[model samples]
Target: MVLSKVGKKINDYATLVMFSHTIFSLSFAVISMMLASKGSPSIHTIFWIIVAFMGARTGANAINRVIDAEIDEKNPRTFMRQLPQRMLKKKEVIVFTAVCFLVMVIAAAMLNPLCVMLSPIALFLMIIYSYTKRFTWTCHLVLGITSAAAPVGAWIAVTGEISWVALFMGAANTLWVSGFDIIYGAQDYEFDTINGIHSIPARFGIKNALCFAALFHVVTVILLVFVGILSGELGVIYYIGLGIISILFIMEHRIVSPDNLTNVKIASYGINQIISITFLIFGFVAVIVK
Candidate 1:
């Protein structure tokens, strides 16, 4: 009975934080880690990188749920989420967030002094992302920037220094993430606009917002091409993977329309998982073959 109760509680927290969403940024982080190491990083570095990412991402999402609880309550689609439904108390989630942040700091310190020094900045970005939607229509972009830290942080963790390649890859990550996030936010358009929650869909309407997402994704692919070139990994395999990602991107937008978003869940979550996994696999192979 006790074990079942513990399992249920764990599942609740995972749902609260959308634990499966970890793949979105972790894929980019793995890409940079492979690129920075030219194949595979030290086992110790890889361990710490994963730890840091989990800590930071979990904490950020937990806090975001708390901050957005009221808004979630108003959105019919999100009303049953743990925080909005009161399945989890704010204090419990906050404690979880604080512990995750501490874990992030420790993981960074274990990686390197540079990572440790930048840990606070990374934490700030994580915290700030939750607040951006309250005031800015460009919150997707803000989220992109925050999510960029994953890949950039991985590069620094492996290389112990930043480089143009890392920056370019980070930019690509930003655009990719922002593009997808815009798609995801489109589902909340009516509720967001009614509640004064800023979002691209709320600002530009779904069709135009999708167009903007497409543009961002185009730039993302271009920036990725640049990453391969500048990073000296200009292999056909990488381009091939990128081509697949582009197709996935197109497919993502295809499933959702301004008038009908019946496949929003598939577009937002299903295809995105495939994209990230494909990119990470190809990145690792490209690095090895280079």
Candidate 2:
């Protein structure tokens, strides 16, 4: 009975890990390759790069959940998580984390020397982001930066060096993620405040925090536009996609208000998913047309 329960718990945790959608990280990598190669990257390169990204993202998220299990237990919104609910053991999480890290290292080694060398640093940032909430409200920004590393790392994987375009993408991702994160944090305002945790919503109240979130997203659009211009790879399809994304962004903000969080789920996951998919499609079209 004990072994069966343990197996079930592991399966549940694994499902959550999969649902975390580290594919978003992989999407950034795909975009980077498209930009760098001006069309398509070799299948071999794409395969190894994706493996590295997935391994790293899974490792990072699992470690984050493990480390924050105590905090999650305290927060109503997160109390149901596997670790917080004691459905999974700490030892199991630790072993899974180590395995994920090993997979990342192996994948990085197969990619290039630069990728291998920087893998540890990238993992460090991902790991550090999990704890930033304990210290500052800037934790959202830290998480943004960590996620932004997807494009930057992917760029390096392709060109094996840093590029201004990659930095631009990183900046866009930074703001995009920070903006949505602010929205997500709104759901935790009461919990955050009661727990003495710092967050934009906890520090500034929802209205002002949401305004800041809008500002960040505006910056995200601007940065992406700037990157497109600099690359000279964008076309009509890209602009159309941008228009849709902008509309979606506006709609995202419109749906959520300080007085009500009814639309929070729609804006955070639903609309954001659309925006990412739009960008990915546009990016692919831009490279193909050029």
By lDDT, the best candidate is 1
Report the lDDT tens digits of candidate 2 across residue range 231-251: 787787877888899999999
- Clashes per model (N, Cα, C within 3 A): 0, 0
The C-alpha TM-scores of every prediction are 0.97, 0.94
Q: Per-candidate RMSD vs. true structure?
A: 1.1, 2.1
Quickly count the clashes in candidate 1: 0
RMSD of 2: 2.1
Error of 2 at 228 (Å): 0.7
Worst 10-residue lDDT window for candidate 1 reads 228-237
